[model samples]
Target: MKIITLTFFSALAISVCSLIGPTSRAATGIGDECNKGGDVKFAIREYDNKLVSVCRADGVGDCLYTKAFGKTFVDNRLHLNSDRLHDYVIKDLSGSYGDNDVTHFMLFAQCRDGNFVKVGDDFFTNLRPDAMDRTTGWLKLRVTRDCYNDSISDTQERSYTIVFDPKKRRYGPPDSNPKLTHYCSDAELALPVGSANSSR
Candidate 1:
């Protein structure tokens, strides 16, 4: 009876220990590898390991190494960080649009529960790089689109000012007066069903 009881208690303890082990979900996201390998320093780890700027032992030279996502390149020139709105980071990412044009846009991210999550939707799809401007608390971007509505089959450009609202936790259109123009979104530009251009 004593031997059987001991075996039952040992099995219960092993089951509980397995439940206490770290979960796979916790090992995902940006900066997840910061804590691994060699000596390291964290420039920004206030949000846990979810969003961090860390230099590992593999860093070039002596502690001069600073990196974010491994292998994922981020343009330092266009990167922006804000503490007034919850230590969020905005990265300007550039990529090819269609086949010919290259487009630029911004991504807003924040740390939540040891994971980095996107904070907002992009306001400009095809941003004009040369026309982008940033002030103390505002971001202005010029967007271009090849608009084709009825007889209008030409490219148009518009300016927009984006502001962050603390309550909303995302960048959005401004409230005050500004020189800006709103255009039809891609959904609106789609040809109607069975229209003359629908097949094409």
Candidate 2:
């Protein structure tokens, strides 16, 4: 078993779900917490704050992945709907299907009272900067059916620029975004392609 750790300082901006009277919110830089795991492990930790995320391996193969006992954490901040506070994006290992393993990306937002809360459902899979962008405070997620494992199949991808509405207290166009693109490739998916048993 091995462990990896990352430490850095960054300021995040995000806001809450409920519409309450505004309070003084600080644009503070949060910290990360992480733990150890399998053949390979990854964690992001901060020296000051209490926030943390960890990913442990559950199964052994060409790639290390978490299943029932496995967990992965991320601490990327996004300015979803507001400028005072920042939203957070996290990644997790959901589960597996046959020879394939699945991961999920979740979004968390802070409220007017200075508390963080989950904004929506598990809305993304294999989420990354290559497939999504949050630089403008609006999210442009290039959606695709994930093929993270060795399994490859016919798939289509789309790109959507989702905006958060403060008046409505929600991200707009809850349904699938407009703009269908092309099929998915192995390199685009960022995982090894072909059968699992095939020699690397």
The models' CA-based lDDT, in order, is 0.35, 0.36
Clashes of each: 0, 9
lDDT of each residue in 64-175, candidate 2, tens digit only: 3223324445437765433446556665554443332334555555444334444433434343332222332334433324333333444323233344443433344322
The numbered model that scores best in lDDT is 2
Global lDDT of model 2:
0.36
Q: Which ten residues in a row have the lowest lDDT in candidate 1?
A: 174-183
Q: Candidate 2: worst 10 consecutive residues by lDDT? A: 30-39
Each model's RMSD to truth, in Å? 15.6, 17.8
Clashing pairs in 2: 13-85, 13-86, 14-85, 14-86, 14-87, 15-110, 16-110, 16-111, 33-52
What is the total number of backbone clashes in candidate 2?
9
How far in Å is the alpha carbon of 46 misplaced in model 1?
A: 22
